[model samples]
Target: MPTLLVTASPHRDEALGNRLARQIAARKGGDLLVRDLAAEPLPPLTVDYARALTLRDPLPRSNATLELSERLIEELESTDRLIIATPMHNFGMPAALKLWVDYVLRIHRTFAPTPQGKVGLLAARPTLVIVSSGGFHRAGESKQPNFLTPHLEAVLSTLGIRAPEFVYLEGLVGRRATPEAMIAEAVAVLGDAWY
Candidate 1:
């Protein structure tokens, strides 16, 4: 499968989610395309851009945001699979990833309005989300809000992607934590889920 791995971890070299995402991609024989969001941060969606999107007006030739938005959407549409590897920052994804999502999930491009409600235009694909959290956020162990998965699932589903398969590397802040154990477990889960 053609896989697009969009990573948002600031510490790309050490992010366990990225490591496990790579393992999953390799196992699936993925023709990998990486979008390093931390290195190349997407601009926030502006009111003008949002207006343009809603009105369906073509931007001028020099509009950088429009150009980038089109490019990102093109990449997403071309891929048959997607993996988003991100660390939990304040119980949500990083700003760069959020900006990327803002750009990609546009009306008339990836989705459309329906009488019942808005519906996705893009074809559904297998999507995976790998998250690394210093604190435990899994069900029953979570004290903090887990806004990341629900937000991502809604946005991805809105764009016609399936509800994502999630892999987590959690409980890294505690003294008893062994990161290696978590990494191994997440990798094993990826293997089972994908293969």
Candidate 2:
């Protein structure tokens, strides 16, 4: 069976997106993996980090962090599907999730440089991202999406994953859209075929 990994922070206590992610995992018929970035905690990318990763040498830091990074990558490589339940924090993703991305996108691992251009090392896979926000900000409406949608797409594309399907649940606090309504929308959108 394939696996679905949902990375996010549950600080808001909003399980709508997370519940939808679980449904997707069930549809995929895989071992569901949920890694709360806030709980697991990934460090920010740094110069030493790049050096250590490129050289395949251990960094003079917490071994646990490095091991978690390795484990995350291994899980990604093995999984057939991925679902990202992300909440927009200050118009972008939480810092923890960004750190998780940094850890997985290693040089010569998730991607490699080619003579023509950078080539993706990961196999093409299906990814469903459920993004929740408190306001409406479509592509042309906002500038901050660059750090959220495009960043994920670029990294996933670099790893050979393409055509990611993202479900945007906007205006949860306003527009009279309660958490229940948002969750219902997500669940309906994810349907049985999504995974």
Q: Which candidate number maximizes lDDT?
A: 1
lDDT per residue (tens digit) for residues 17-51 in model 2: 66667756775675776677756676666666666
* Predicted candidate 1 versus true structure: per-residue lDDT over 80-151, tens digit per residue: 998899989999988888989889998888888889877888888888898888888877987899899999
Task: Choose the strongest candidate by TM-score.
Answer: 1
Write down the RMSD of all candidates, one decimal each.
1.9, 3.3
Candidate 2 lDDT for residue 10: 60
TM-score of 1: 0.90
**If scored against the real structure, what TM-score would every candidate get?**
0.90, 0.81
Where is model 1 poorest over a 10-residue stretch in terms of lDDT? 172-181
Off by over 4 Å in 2: 44-48, 54-65, 139-146, 187-192
RMSD of 1: 1.9
